[model samples]
Target: MTSATHRSAAEIGRTATGPRPLPPLGSQSSATELSHVDTTLSNGLRVVAVRKATVPLVEVRVWIPFAGEDKLHPATAEVLAETLLTGTARRDRVEIDAELALIGGDLGTGVDPERLYVTGSALSSGLPTLLDVLGDVFTGAAYTDAEVGRERERLIERIAVSRTQPRTIAREALQKQRYGDHPATREVPEASDVEVVTPERVRALHAASVLPRGSVLVIVGDIDPQTVPGDLERALGGWASDRSAPRLPALPELTGGNVLLVPRAGAVQSQIRLSAQTVPRTDPRYAAVQLANLAYGGYFSSRLVENIREDKGYTYGAHSGFEFTDQNATVNVDADTANEVTAAALLETRYELGRLGLVPPTGEEVESVRQYAIGSLLTSTSSQSGLAGQVMALASTGLGVEWLQEHPARVAAVTEEEVAQAALDFFAPKRFTGVVVGDADLLAPKLTALGDVTVGEQD
Candidate 1:
């Protein structure tokens, strides 16, 4: 082998080779402006448009900040979100789907406590029809009694199916234990909750929460800013504005020193999730934490992957992430291993945390993470749809376009010290609430020596 191969093998995995040269700008690269125009119609609808002359497609996204924030029960918001797509005044469910199909376009909507987004994408040539269809579905929906009943049944079926999936059950249990009685803690609404999701309730929610004035409209593709804004205004002219922001209570911080475990009897493998509150999107530590996460277990080549999969073949892959939100943050590390190795895998993961924090990775390891992150960011923002997604997030959070553009520099600016500090902040296995979906009788004794393991059935 060459001297280069020898050096690579000897190098500690914590150092970067050298600073990366910036990529070229202009049409040769994704250096174009995130040009957009913002206006409100006479009826209080807010309209924003971004022009991307390269792709032959357009994306329209409508956001509602209601599902995850309200003081209502945890599952109610998600049930309401699922109910909206059932049918409407102008078209039944089949007809609505057929219309979107004809243009090769797609219609979709999602809800979290903090926001709801109804989005669609289509060829640029089909923008007018797509926008018209969305306007009809969102603003002019009938919310009939028959449709509401049908949707309620469907949501019930979904909840029933989720119980059989080990991974799904584990996640739901984790959210409940982690968030406690907080509104965001709950998973999907059951059939009984859906029974109360009346047409009147959905309609009331539409009026009170789905404010077009607070909404963001994104048009990306071969569209002109000057022309696109007018079309959006015409389409959403009837949408009402709301000056008042949705009232969301502060999320309670996680309390101390307990490990939560959900055990599934007779299961061959254990699915584990350990999490804690971390940093928010607007926090300056966001970028630093992001890079640090990439090195820990966020990436395919992260420390957990090397230890769990390479060094000891415990599972396919182990990873961690920092999910940033408007108000709260979550840093979770997830992995799945057989009952016998579950305890060992968890111990190894803890060791990695200590090594990354207490023994700070070399400069090379840090640079590798930086390069991988920035490179991924560059590729993801190459399309018109991608650019529009970035813009929508910025507009919603009131972050500037420059923030997106400067992401690479910020990531590159992260020092080894910051990464070590982030590691120290996030990785405390002793504080983790562990969920193990496996043959609990066999796994409990093995895991108890590691920490205080609370075992409960998956039901």
Candidate 2:
């Protein structure tokens, strides 16, 4: 073979003039105006159907406000979601599966403290069958004793495994620290409560909480937007109630204070979770806040990750993102670091937070994150499923496809000054409070010495 020379990575990245400048981002194309209908059916379900004719498949999402203050509400709600599609009066579990399979369809149900979610998909031709199956389950799910018993045991096992996870433990501590005993904190149900859940309790909850008056149904794919609402009304006409679905009680605002040091004895690594309250998506300042978040820690190239992960090697990854609960929203930052460096990681994490406000993202940094924000929006809604999910989230907040189409313009209009202001107002170090969970013996001295940190009893 003839000998050949290869350039080093540095050489390959350079031109005669030196390092090459990156090509400018191409002009972004606006999304096609979606053909969609946003109408409330006579049966009280808000139906939003969009015609995307790109594929022969249709995606479905249902959101029902399923909140309760009862002590056993979470456990019962969990069991109800597990068995919701297991059987209906007209079809047993296997029969339900068979009918959907014949139509290239599948369905799943899940619940959290704030809402119940039923997500499904099917071939466009099978839209009628999918709606009929959904209507049947909504109106007449049996929650048979056998099905409830089996699923309860499985849920209990899953909960047991999840509760032991480091992330789960951190999440629980943070939720409690931020919200006190708000029902929204009941994200993972207690195994003891799930064990005591009976079929009767599940059915009772199904009747009381799974109403249609305050629910939303989103359908996107190759379908007629105008006709789908009529079809939904016909199929689900019986699944109605005068009582609206219950919204969760508003959460008390979070106040920043000392970080709680929760002891996870003998752990080799630690989880650092930080949170601060912020405006919801509907707020006028939200677009600016969104960009500020991306530049801070919402994206991989953010200040927090660049400082802690790339420059300092404190953690494998670090992220900050928004969490929207109903009409409320908050920014959350998290990282997992070795026990040896957890204290240092926390310091740098806060340092970056403070720097984001004081130093602020430069004009170049703002432009970079702005492009990422718009590009991600376009990418996420490029598919039928993605569009459906996006619409569902907006509809839950009383918005529709119009908001989806207009969000890019909103983001584009946010000025660099607005972003800097948002960073200063929302990302101040004094505006955050959270938890540092690790071995107290190893972490307490260094962490407590860091100030704004308090050692707590072992968890």
Candidate 3:
């Protein structure tokens, strides 16, 4: 019964019709509260057990302050971290792997200038087995000749490869400029030194610094909180040592200076690494500083990224963020660009830094960054593994579950004026000092033209 006078599809689509308006984004709410029990073992082992029953799994994080005070310690500790779990007195590498696999668990180890870390996860019921094996490896690792030789060679090779990277050169140069002969600057040891480390040296270094008396452990899982502490105490009781009788010396304070140009021969790219000391999480101003950082260069849509990456096309990425150690905190800004525009990029970078502190963020900008900060904090700890890592890392800095549960409110309460004040106090261009790594011959003319650059020792 329909008439045949209907227009074609293209003709019918010519009418002027408006689409429906979308709803505005809702305001941010409070983050999820983390519930956990905190206790200390008799031997000075800080233990925090968080109850997360979303799945039948557990995450364990053990952090040891293995301060590499000398070249020997740094090289030896590097080898030790690689070979620690390869074997134990009772369990060879094969036995250890099989034992962990049997319980649906896995283990990994890493060492930085500040600490040695052992991280793993397992089914909730297998927590006891996981702890037993970790204890065995920590207390009685069998550093056999074959295992030490193999791991040492592999580590040396990796270091050689890493040293060739421009970012690695920039990082090392920046570390030296900041810390200056301090042990904290020796995160990556010389390959020649690592090649000379013997098995006996690794065993001795382990005996000296890897003490349970000065470490912390965190466990998050679907288990009874009342019984988990007892399980941990019994499993790790015998890992006692008086070597770290009091504690390792804390990191020294860092100072900043003019940019140091580190020469890399015959290169076409430059890496800019910037650093400045900042406040710890315990400071009341921390929340405000976090928001200011997000607005400036702490996120993808920040002013620094917009200026350098999007607006000017000087670099592919530009970011600024914070780094926290046991007793020290620092802000770092990083960017890489083509050889010809290195000076221009650096100039724009400094200009943005000044602009952030001087003009500060408006109320709208502050609110956007505040929401991002709160949302990220909540999302990071939503999973068992993520929560365990967060709590454990904070525990090492003397923060607790109370801080984690309450930081969102602090971030939410930060006013625009406070964010502006934090920016002015901490983010001034004068506060930062760093290095520029590139081909010296290619970069020397323009970099020298930029002035305030000194020739630094190159890798």
Candidate 4:
């Protein structure tokens, strides 16, 4: 018994004894080693190249400053951006698909409200071949009438199906209510508009929107800048750097509080969206507002999520985001929850907004969110795909490469008081526009206590 007791005491001492190593104090130091981007092209094509010898893959992205905001030939720019890959002068749809499939590569393009992006990824061994193919597709696309009609059908089908999704309907409705007649608010084209979109319009938009002077080329992974730039220039130099397009128009003024509720027949839940005017992308308060939004409802542990989801069990998720574009800026909050709790959830969201106006985040919380955002940004820069995305964002916004290099410091310098001020400026209830998609008949009585309500229905 004495022997066993001594052995146990020794074991306990061993378990509790000795010094433990401390964790790395504080967060990681700001990333000092960033990619070397040379913006040498004079025709406004911001070229970004990263020569990483480790991976045998390359990601090339061409971001053109042509999106819905440009609106040159109705919807032609967007249609061209979408269907360019369907056929080029040298390659038809089937042939192009077969070639890309054989090499396990993909061709894709998209249009947001502010910019058009064409992106493709392929193995480094196939870089030279892919470049030729990419050049042909970008510069030599033939927007045939057949292709236009086909893509129109596909788009119509997409719209028809998307309208059935509650989230999609809610988002479209919300934008219309928030922005009113602004072209940015037109998320989906009507059947009349879609039918009128012709091949001639698509060709006309291509001529005006895809100007070499306003484009940027970003290439990352196993590549040398010297050789790649020369080759790209040769392949794409034929593109005239003529400045033909006019400057984008001034953004429309914020259309004040108008609620739009699209009445669905029997919706079990309601999707609600609230938006208010915010500072533009170049605004000095951009980073400060970002930190404040994180504290409000931008993250998983944000106040809105903690209160509405964790405590109240009212929503699957509730979050907010800031949309910074060339013409306008806005902060948006979204939640989808049971119909019975819709008004409560909205009121709680308003309460959070009002609270931010009254009291700001603590210095500690502000710093934490700043650190979180910077860390995430750095982590994104670590990958070639993410690096290319960063370049594309800078190009789309007419920001220089140095903008990203200085982002961490900018975020770090934002003070708690500044964040509070940004919140008040952005989250004014009077400026907020509300939109709901659900059974209006069921939700009317429940939401009537909040304010005067107007309901709309789709044909």
Report the candidate with higher lDDT, 2 versus 3: 2
Among all windows of ten consecutive residues in candidate 4, which has the lowest summed lDDT? 66-75
Please tell me which model should have the higher lDDT, number 1 or number 2.
Answer: 2
The full ranking of all candidates by TM-score, starting with the best, is: 2, 3, 4, 1
lDDT string, candidate 2, 1-459, tens digits: 899799898888899998988889899888679999999988678989999989999999999999999999999999999999999899999999999999899999999999999999999999999999999999999999999999999999999999989999999999988988999999999999999999999999999989999899999999999899889988898998989999999888887888999999988999999999999988999999999999999898999889999998999999999988888899999999999999999999999889989999999999999999999999999999998999998999898899889899999999999999999999999999999988999999999999999988864
Residues 1-459, candidate 4: write the lDDT tens digits.
Answer: 355434564454553555444344376567555445566465556677766555788888887666445433335655676688888789988988887776667778887555567788888777776777777776777888899889877877776787688888887777677656666665555655666788888877777677767677888778876677777777776666557323344556564575567788789999988887777657788898888888889888777888899999999999998766665677889999898898888778878887777777777678767878888888887787887787666666667557777888889888888988887877656767778788888887767667745667654
Best candidate, TM-score-wise? 2
lDDT score of model 1?
0.72
Q: What is the lDDT of residue 447 in candidate 2?
A: 97
Ranking by lDDT: 2, 3, 4, 1
Candidate 3, poorest ten consecutive residues by summed lDDT = 242-251
TM-score for candidate 4, residues paired by index: 0.85
Best-fitting candidate, scored by lDDT = 2
Clashes (candidate 4): 0
Steric overlap count per candidate: 13, 0, 0, 0
Global lDDT of each candidate? 0.72, 0.93, 0.86, 0.74
**How would you encode candidate 3's per-residue C-alpha lDDT over 26-135 as one tens digit per residue?**
77667666567888887778888888999999999999888855668778988999999999889999999998898899999999888899999999888899999988
Error of 1 at 98 (Å): 4.6
Steric clash pairs (candidate 3):
none
